[model samples]
Target: MTITPQNADDSCLINQTVPTGVMSPPSEYLDEKKQLPNQNQNQNQNSTSHSGEDQESQKGRSRSIEDATAPLPSSSSSDRGDDNDNNDDDDDFPEGGLAAWLVVFGSFCSMVCLYGLINSVAVFESYFSTHQLAGYSSSTIGWVFSVYLFIVFFFGVQVGPIFDRHGPRLLVAVGSLLVVASQLILGLCEEYYQILLTYAVLGGIGGALLNVPAYGVIAHFFKRRRGMAVGVAATAGSVGGIVFPLFLQAVIPKLGFAWSTRIIGFILLFLSVIANLLVRSRLPPSTHPVRILPDWTLFKDLKFTLCCVGVWFMEWGIFTPLTYIVSYAAAHGQDANAAYTLLSILNAGSFFGRFLPGFLADRFGRFNVITITNALCVVTILAFWLPAGDSRALLIVFAVTFGFASGSNLGLYPVCIGQLCDARDYGRVYSTAVMIGSFGTLTALPIAGALLEIGSDERQGWLALILFAALSYAIATSCFLGARVLAVSWRVKEVY
Candidate 1:
């Protein structure tokens, strides 16, 4: 069937509501089931003679379902038969091989440009709120970043389907242009609305476009090693997170914010260009038509639906700390510059946090790893961050530990969702989750700002913020447990 953009999006929403196994039932089975009763009766009369053919057909259907549902296996008997198999070596991921590593490298570069910029948004908020956009309320400026995040996620509802139909090549190309343009324009905008339109809406759209391709391509290359592959690629965001803040610190002083932003835009241009070239899907081209709409029906699967909810709440709580950490430090007698530096420290820890835990997760189970990491984020926030409002040492520790723990949220979320459906439907599944998550992104920042407004002191704001983080963790934990129940109910010792 031709999966048009609209149909693809519709499918994404549908995938959420329906089990992938049911939606794309073995096409062969559907075809066979449609055969004439006369043919069936003839086959039944010669049942013994046709038994081998039936068994072979059944085997083929089973293999198709397995490939659709899980990581496609590495080897096939066909590999030995294809005389002109130029792709023989390319079929299976090399795991630690140079090509796989190169893909990982490319993925890292992509994340640095996309996720790094996202994590560093707080630095912009901290600086902009007190400087050029000072006339605007914190709530208004918060909307700028919030809108950026929302578009980045919301637009994915469309981008994911397109990626499924066409490979990442064209989408990445257009996204690269949009992102670079948004940055260049953002450098020139001095007005509140201009910043809102350029940075929040435009940059967000570009980021969203870049994001799906960045992580989605990993699925095409590696299956068994997917967790580690995605984790390694995910670390690029932390690299960007660390790099961009340091870039801002140096550039803002010498060139000032306007030119500094322009320089960063140029850097994004370079990275996005490289990303456009390198991040590619190894999977054969999809024959599906271009469908761009989100399929809300995918939520019908209680496990996936719960996962979407968990991600929504997780993202909502995530940016609260990212956006507010510097401001919180500044309010607590920390130097403004020093306060901004704390984000960098947190991102630095996030770098390793994204990489190492993925390796662990591959062995321990995706849901299990995510549950533990999320718990760590909540506990660390409550134990260290909540009380460390005035203690620079404690806050720094919280930042590093939380960064490490939370890093998994970004890296493993896609894989966790991927676990529930067929490989071909991954784009739809992921995009649908992000569609729901878009609402959370839209509201998280503004809500955090409102929380700050309610408190007399920033310390109280920190408490409220930490509570938000903990609540999200609790919700995420329940979702993970529910998924575990669906797959392997109440068996605590059983690996998810």
Candidate 2:
């Protein structure tokens, strides 16, 4: 009846019964002792020996059921200490280094290509209205850019999940080809349908493919300093915004729209190559297939839902100015070159706005900075832009001020969303939010264009459009404030 530790695993032990006279302690008591250092070895040895007539009976009973049931002792604390060290190593991040910054540089290049074009939509709008597509209504021309913006964001719903499963290389490389091809083909389009098919559909799809991974890759190398890193990359778009308008203005006169677009296409080809080389995902791919799909259940989170709503409104108002400022300026009496300069000036202010708020968002709080900027967007539109009319100085001020205020809208949305979930799920969450926001971008511009068709004069129509944009910002600011309050209480000092 006596059981030894060496015989513990034997099948014979399973049916053995202890004697009735000797009682065994409960399993829980022995389980607790098993957690202590090497004590189970002594307890086992002691239980093996018994004296007197009861020796045989006691021996039978000492075949401890608790010892049989308990798990084997864990490895020494020194071994566990090594395990802890290994875990710490796994969590370590390369916050800033040459490789990390190179990734940032790659993202910057990609943004310049994607966002630069997005910001320069006004230049194209102005040009098409006055030249090639002059017979088309403004609302009709508006669809080309609106569709482009729509595809750029809406397509991310699929591209994001693919990036999560496959990584960024192929997506970006393919995107580079499509974007460069779009630009090259864009110069050849003489008809309205040709322009829409070439620029809006093809260019938009390319931008979507390039844009998601560009921003997504930054999150991989940065966590603590992500705001600044993302900010730096986002500035490339504004720089592109500034440079493209000026480039188009100068080249369209000299080389004509066709060759000018081809030149820009060549520049984009070079930038896309850099993006394909530099922008890479640091994290391992998700093994779960479900992870690669949009989880609509995430919208159930009230804070996230509110954040998306806020972004939707922000996007609704944002592109209205970017798309119309040149037209607005020209309509109000500014000459062609001056109107294009105004677009560049807006982007110039945005170049600073993109990075500075990002630098501060890391310290002050992403939502805090975003909320403040959103409020400022409302103020600038209502106060500065709406009343400017033909006043050249006032229009310039509005362009710069509104540019600075709204620049954070694009840069900070991803940063703010990153705060709400695990880094691995960032692609899904971010793309889903943007997909929803794309509706606003798709509708906002055309609506503004239609609004421009209203009223006795261009100024009256523009005033209505400006008021609409201001109202959208006001709602966006309120939603962001609500999200901020839901995430972190009204405690004035919290750094969330």
Whole-model Cα lDDT of every candidate shown, in order:
0.73, 0.78
Query: Least accurate stretch of 10 residues (summed lDDT) in model 1?
Result: 1-10
Candidate 2 clashing pairs, residues 3+ apart or interchain:
none
Those runs of model 2 whose alpha carbons end farther than 4 Å from true positions after fitting are 1-91, 290-293
- Judge candidate 2 at residue 76 and give its lDDT: 32
- Per TM-score, the best of the predicted structures is 1
Candidate 2, residues 203-307, lDDT tens digits: the string is 998999987898888877776577889999999979999999999888888999999999999999999888888989876664336343566777776767888
Number of residue pairs clashing in candidate 2, backbone atoms closer than 3 angstroms, sequence gap of 3 or more or interchain? 0
Regions of candidate 1 where Cα sits further than 4 Å from its true position: 1-96
lDDT at residue 129 of model 1 (Cα atoms): 92
> Model 1's lDDT to the true fold?
0.73
Please state the error at residue 254 of candidate 2 in Å.
0.9
C-alpha TM-score for every candidate: 0.82, 0.82
